[model samples]
Target: MSQSASDQSDRTSPVKTQSPLILDSLPDIPGVEDCSLRVQQKIDLILLAIEALELGGSEYMLATAKELELQSIVDNRVALWRMRCSNPWRRSHVRTRLTLKQGKALTLIASYRARQLTVLIRQLLVAQQQIQEKGLPLEQHFRLSDYLERFRAHFRSRMNPRRAKVAVYLADENQLNDLALSLLSQLLFCTGTYGLKRLWVSLFDGEVA
Candidate 1:
């Protein structure tokens, strides 16, 4: 080939390279990304509480408020993260502390951000009751279908297109439910861009599911 033609060919040629497929592959570490830490911590605490209940029963679990406190701590962290990452300094400066009375009143609000944890707490109490009556397995994996239904119900009840958007996070298994996932996708889109949008769901492994 002529020198000019060879030079032109080289310029037009596509280059092949290999590097770590960080985006394609899930991150090994959990809670490495923004917003994930709070979710992971809450889930872990819920599971731990479940284990404690199975071992000791209701009286034992309620006697200690460690799980509840841990959940609160994670909730505070989520608030802090949102303030730092998204909101302006002026707006973020607003007080987020919860007084005893205020905390009691805001339990429902807390459930919005920590739905899984809240549900787990209720389930633990029920399981404790059941165990007292009849023994049962302690480690229970929540049904994906039930979880999704609860999420959708929560969205339908609280979602305000003018005010806030609904965010749904799905695990890998949940994502495989194409019909449900698509419905959620449509709901999010209809919620609009100006108001709150659904936060993209992440996998248990900290990958985008």
Candidate 2:
């Protein structure tokens, strides 16, 4: 066999192996507890979609999104109408239908969001693992707490600085006029307790002291 033929045979061999990328350690955010179970299913779905995209290109994602939207709309409408029924037996039937519809909608939305989040986390994990494997430079990692603190700080700075005082009063006039001096004593006690900053009074056929 010619040297060139041998080289071509080697290049076209079916048993060629590439090194698989392995992740070392994943992020340890507090909310990421049970991370393996929570993220594995998502990661699997995402990887499948990514493989599909590699095979079918952008058309596959668009088609899938469109199909998902159609299903979502149908499910939403069914759930809404089902909840509107009044009869007990019919309501029960409708409620079951609504639950199923909502479940389907939630599953689709959760699956899609999970796929996106998994892709992001996988990218970070791969990059970090690669750095560790190569003994290369390290990048700063942000945890959930750090992100939340920054958010809170930004929100606090943007809020209004002034504070206002408010007071509420409930009064009954019927008891006040009938008991005369007894009502006056009650009014004085209440006024002191309520921190009356100023006093104003009006009297009919009478003079103020």
Candidate 3:
């Protein structure tokens, strides 16, 4: 094999042995580049939700990368920030396309973290359900309220308020909270079996023809 191919193999070897949750690679879907924008946005949001769920989330993300043996792609905090900034919605958006390999690494890290936080995620979801069933506001439950508040704060600080899409979310508290809840549900999905593969495919839903 070529040096690049051999190096790639060496990199993935650890992931296979590190955890059952780690995927060697995602399927080679056509037109992935065209869909990368959407993929980047979803990935960033997933991580953002995770950050909201826990204090010092960025640090956890870096540590998770090391724990998952995905540092070759994630590298460090600056690299992580650059990858996330690829999201066009960010205030410090960087014009870069997320490579398939980088996306897979992030998916693995996200699913693994989601699994670790499964109990808390379930509790939050249940609280959300109870709140909706009683027609009560989100803040009625303290933990859920805290998570939603953190999500909104992160969104406001990182997302560019000048953008039209972001302005709508900034103006409407309900709309933004709904997005946070939706992401919370997605995190729950990530904790399930084959969750990484499921999210991998879903990322290209519309772009793949």
Candidate 4:
């Protein structure tokens, strides 16, 4: 075999030995939501490197994040989150403090549900605009997610099937079984440029059909 082929054949990395994060913890990989396989692999590598720096502290963490260009993503939300969760700052939130259990729960939620939550927040922005246009007639009880559902139905009928399907696929990342697609049109209409970027990423995640 050739030198490259011989090296590839000899390599055998065990799954059990792989780490959860790349560095001391997770670096901001904002593009993971819409990344190519190569980009996704690099994200995994960043996580691993962060995991390895578990005891490296904030200075080292920020330094590494800067080195990796993590701040360039999402106005540095991930980098700022890491900084807030680090020493001195973690215990004193500008918003409020939480118990260890609450903190753990939130961390878990952010890890898996960040995209969902961001979409929800963006949806609320859309609902707010509608409310502004409608003038004063505030309901005593209202649910924005309901508005998202209704808006999707109206928007879907107005859109071509191909375009609508593409929007639905992008919104839910091809989760056909999930009702999240009902918010597709609203999501794109509200979240602006980042939402467009997220939609592009969805295509990479196999949303294109």
lDDT of each: 0.31, 0.29, 0.84, 0.33
Candidate 3: the clashing residue pairs are: none
Q: Score every model by TM-score.
A: 0.20, 0.22, 0.88, 0.22
Name the 10 consecutive residues with the lowest summed lDDT in model 3: 14-23
The candidate scoring highest on TM-score is 3
Clashes of each: 3, 0, 0, 17
Candidate 4 stretches greater than 4 Å from native: 1-18, 21-111, 117-119, 137-141, 144-209
Q: In model 2, what is the error at residue 121, expressed in angstroms? A: 1.8
Task: Put the candidates in lDDT order, highest first.
Answer: 3, 4, 1, 2
Give the CA lDDT, 0 to 100, for residue 94 in model 4. 31
**Candidate with more favorable, higher lDDT: 2 or 3:** 3
Instruction: Report the candidate with higher lDDT, 1 versus 3.
Output: 3
Ranking by TM-score: 3, 4, 2, 1
Candidate 2 overall Cα lDDT vs. reference? 0.29
Q: Candidate 3, overall lDDT? A: 0.84
Per-residue lDDT over 151-190 for candidate 1, one digit per residue giving the tens place of the 0 to 100 score: 4443333223232211232223233233333433332232
Tens digits of per-residue lDDT for model 3 on 30-95? 755533777899999999999999999889888988787666567689999999998989999999
